[model samples]
Target: MPIPIELSLHRHSRVLEIAYEDGTRFKLPCEYLRVYSPSADVQGHSPDERVLQVGKEQVGIDKIEPIGHYAVCLHFDDEHNTGIYSWEYLYRLGNEYEARWNAYLDELKQAGHVRKTLDA
Candidate 1:
């Protein structure tokens, strides 16, 4: 069964406090979440068509809209708002953030893109 995620927005800190039904809590920066959104813009039509997001150090969640019982829509200040993040998908993202983020950085390095870590 997929775990339920209760994500609370903390505008002051620019972080999303994501809590899982399994007792996991993640304080994810908005920029990190925004850059990795599972939308067609980022994921593309297939894995081989994925596009790397660059220069997202200043991105923030402009709004969070509810989507039925399946997901939440994230509107980014940078104008990215197509993804509907399901609880199951959000849980997976939080669980694999560190590893996946590192992989993203590696890919960026290979492509000569440098990532700027912003303090949230």
Candidate 2:
């Protein structure tokens, strides 16, 4: 697993920066993190049962807590705090960001949902 050496959340930019031991860094947008949350609400119990999240274009993290040297729990402003993102999962998310984000957009379109930014 590519463990993170540094983690920084930029509230103003609504991005989370994670630097790994291998010198790789990822700047993940809050909306992407929220929609792709590892929580059961999003991932479900199985691949076939995964839910398509929508209307989280402006979602942001309110807080973050490190979990026992393995993962981090993200507290979103929308009150989502169940997901515990492991270093491996986070690494995958970052590395496959473009494809995953595109897939999400396609899913939204197919579901006839429109992306909207929440008002500050």
Candidate 3:
């Protein structure tokens, strides 16, 4: 698995910048991370039990806690601090960002929820 060489949080822009040793970099929005959190509260035990997170367009990370040599725990400003994001998972998230993001948008649209525009 590729390991992250750097992780930078851009609080003002609500983005987490991750650079991997394989020369791949991803600028993940906080909202995306929050909604796609790997926590049980979000992912659930089964695929059908997963929860769809809403109203997280402006969610920001309050803190990032490293978990040994394998993962990091994100503490969201919304008080969500359960997900243990492993290096592999983070890499996957980056790699599949476009498809995943579009899927999320589609799901929201199907649920009849309109996403609010974030204030710049």
lDDT against the true structure, per candidate, is 0.82, 0.93, 0.95
**Candidate with the larger TM-score of 1 and 2:** 2
| Global local distance difference test of model 1 | 0.82
Best TM-score goes to which candidate? Answer: 3
Ranked by TM-score from best down, the candidates are 3, 2, 1
Residue 48 Cα positional deviation in candidate 2, in Å, after optimal superposition? 1.7
- List the candidates' TM-scores in order: 0.88, 0.94, 0.98
Could you give candidate 2's per-residue lDDT for residues 27-100 as a string of tens digits? 99999999999999999999998999877877789999999999999999999999999999999999999999
lDDT of 1 by residue, 1-120 (tens): 355567788877778888777788878878778867889989989999888888877777879998988789999888899998888778777888899888877988999987776654
**Candidate 3 C-alpha lDDT tens digits along 29-117:** 99999999999999999999899998899899999999999999999999999999999999999999999999999999999999998
Candidate 3 C-alpha error for residue 85, in Å = 0.2
Question: Top model by lDDT, which number?
Answer: 3
Full-model lDDT, candidate 2:
0.93
